[model samples]
Target: MTEVRGRMWVRGEPADGFTFSAISDCLTSEDTLVWADIYDPDHDTLTALAEELKLNMWAVEDATAPNERTKATVYRTHTFFTVYAIQMLTAVGDSTSTLVKHRISAFVLPRGLITVRLPPVAGDDPGFGMDEVSQRFDELGGQQYGVGALVHGLLDVVVDGHFDAVQDLDDGIESLEDELFDEDGPKRGLQRRTFRYRKDLVELRRVVLPMREVVSAIKSRRLDAKTSPELNPLYDDLYDHVLRASEWTESLRDMVTTVFETNLSLQDARLNTVMKKLTGWAAIIAVPTAITGFYGQNVEYPGLNTVAGFVVSSALIVLLVAVLYVMFRKRDWL
Candidate 1:
């Protein structure tokens, strides 16, 4: 019931309410191109569209399933593309934001473009930003370029998302770098934050890395509705954005790794400093213990068992410890 069809752009003229039931009716003139947007369709609805549109059964299966990796698969009459649209949620304190991937599947048919958006998942799943996608489509106005225009607009939206997510991750890494040096910052949280960055980047990279192949597959003119030579420049621009996102993420992953290793090094240095201070103090205290043991011997030569000898021994112990203390303090070993 949430399903809705967008106003069709035929050549340069706009028409509305081209339902799936009536899809068999002629919507495509030589210059007419139909674009349909479906949201969270039920099983019966998908089956019905598949029957009417002659969508490949395997492609329909993949469309309904969640968690499909980003890919492009070519069918006889249509090409199916699986792509993710990303939305970020900010976390509390110094931690980086969370990334929510909304799964989107598209079928590039000969005469039209069909976009199927999965429903929002539980928790902080930011549903696909349909408004931005719609705004991009609306920009077509009178310059409709058939199905190519629709596919271009939609892919443009998705690629921009990848770029934004990568940039946000870069910013998060920069913030983490600042806290890494701060003396008063929470050491434990910094460690956890870096780990989070590594994890998030891995996930982001997984989603983003395949986008190059997906976009390239389309730009290479393998699909029925692949970019025309006129639209090749646009697809090339999109490919450039994809490449930048992929490369930036690669460098960020290494940065996160460095942060983790540097934290370990810092911790080891701190432990060594603490252990050195403890050993110096223990050495200073041992001088008194050894003097007392010497004085307690049964057979002694110098003033054995006398009050004057006891005072002299005590004074010598105090003077020796004081000298050691001064030396240790001056050397900063205590």
Candidate 2:
């Protein structure tokens, strides 16, 4: 699917077709500011656009590839940027799984912006949606500012998403911490929760950390001369957001680690307590076992024929066990 926004430069009006020919004609006929958004463009479409825009073959190939790391690269007359958009799906069983990420690639030029997106699976929301953003841009009269404002708007949405995801992770960690420390309550699946949160944090970091460098490159004005000066500040703001997101991700990872360690320590302590109790009970039972074993002998034993002997022996076993229990209790060992 292809979407075109904005008016023709020559006619100063919105253009119709978003194809390579239409866009090239619009750019040539007049100085129109247009944006062409492509969703999973076909091979032929990609090749045609690359040829028309003179995009590097390597960069085009990279854009088509899956799970490419987030980064920005500058080529002659155009700048290419790839970024990941993350969305948290519903919590499944013990873990909260995230929907597959969308890899969005943008070709930034002076007159127009071309974006390529990988469509989401059925019933999944595309991480980057332009409905609200487009409305906001139109409300602000975005045509006057060209594509720079549009780029900023889109990035702003992505940054907000990061903030929400981080906040959810923090909430999950806090809940796990409470469960870990609960004295009278069962842990209630806390181990599984912590493991799941850790996994999500790792994945989120992988997507967000490299975006810092991508945004910084743009803010540093390292792109080709065709990039508009007005876009620099927007990129700088986006860079700041990326830095903040990275910091939050790092902090969340540390918290997950701490939660895991604390859980292990708590489990170890519980095990030790159980072992101590079992050891105490074993010691208490040993005296009876020893006394009975001696009295059960068939050989000529004095205790075998006498009721007094049996009573004395039984009394001795009970007394010995009581004494041992008292000693253990006094020493705070049980």
Candidate 3:
């Protein structure tokens, strides 16, 4: 079922409950910031809201488009911004888990914010939504900025979600590194785990790298009064986080690749060591086989068919075998 999550904040406090259709009534002052959130709404619902809000039809179409890159677009009266919130990536129930990119498009008006969320149909939960974002607004009760503060809160939550995912990936990589050297840990799942981590890092980089440009555009374009001078510090902090998330993901990818290569090298070295032992033992055994075969020949040869000669040949075989065994063992080929 589709859900519409929204709130009206007046004078930095949440006003009484109001419907999305009555959004215009909420914009009573320069201090008012109206936020409306919808998830996977039908065409009729979106069309009605677009007409009600006077939003550009082209921006609405882009919002409803199936796939969108993280970007910011300017319109005559407002700006359209699209961003993503990361859900998670994990192993669940033998299926291929995915990195959930919860696409959220925003209509940044001078005094209002309208958001549309395109979440996966199933199992892509990161336990965050507009309710959480609205709380950030309410938490700042009695302090008023404008639409810029609200936009910063939204982007902050999204970027913070990516930060958490990056931290989780780092922990997984650390644990895998430990298990790589552990002798008793189960070895069967290491390959799958490493591959999943690498895949997730790639996906994360795709999502996070573009965010730097998105925020910078919003900060620089000064879309209407939405880019207030007071918001400079907050947006600057958010840009720093985006930079950190992108750099961390690349470093983690390199680490995972190194671990995977080192594991293969260790396996090959072990195989070579086993082969050396087998070859050394084969050489030691061939000495006895050659002496017995020569002695058992039907024709006469030296040291055959006589007790004294047989004893001397037997001693000769034992001495040669012992000498070879000592040499091989000294060379660590046993």
TM-score of each: 0.87, 0.85, 0.88
For 1-334, candidate 3 gives per-residue lDDT tens digits of: 5688777777766676767777877765676668888887777889887887788888888888987788888777788989888876565722254567788899988788888877565653663467767777666442267777778888888998899888988898888899778876437778777788888888888888889888888777654344357778777888999999989888998999987887777778778988999999899899989988877889977656689887887898999999999999999999
lDDT of 2 by residue, 106-150 (tens): 887656677777766555564566565556555545444555655
Arrange candidates, best lDDT first.
Answer: 3, 1, 2
Which candidate wins on TM-score? Answer: 3
Worst 10 residues of 1 by lDDT: 221-230
Taken over the whole model, the C-alpha lDDT of each candidate is 0.79, 0.73, 0.79
Better structure of 2 and 3 per TM-score: 3
Q: Cα deviation in Å at residue 106, candidate 1?
A: 0.2
Residue 173, candidate 1: alpha-carbon lDDT: 82
What does candidate 1's lDDT look like per residue over 1-334, in tens digits? 5676665655557766577666545344656667777888787888888888788988888998978889998777888999999877777654554878888898887667788888877655667757777688777442355666677788889988888888888897888778777887445588878877888899999999999999898777544334345676777898998998899999999998988888788778778878989988898789888988888888856978789988988898899889988998898888
Better of 2 and 3 by lDDT: 3
Clashing pairs in model 1, backbone N/Cα/C closer than 3 A: none
Clashes of 3: 0
Q: What lDDT does candidate 1 reach at residue 24?
A: 44
Q: What TM-score does candidate 3 reach?
A: 0.88
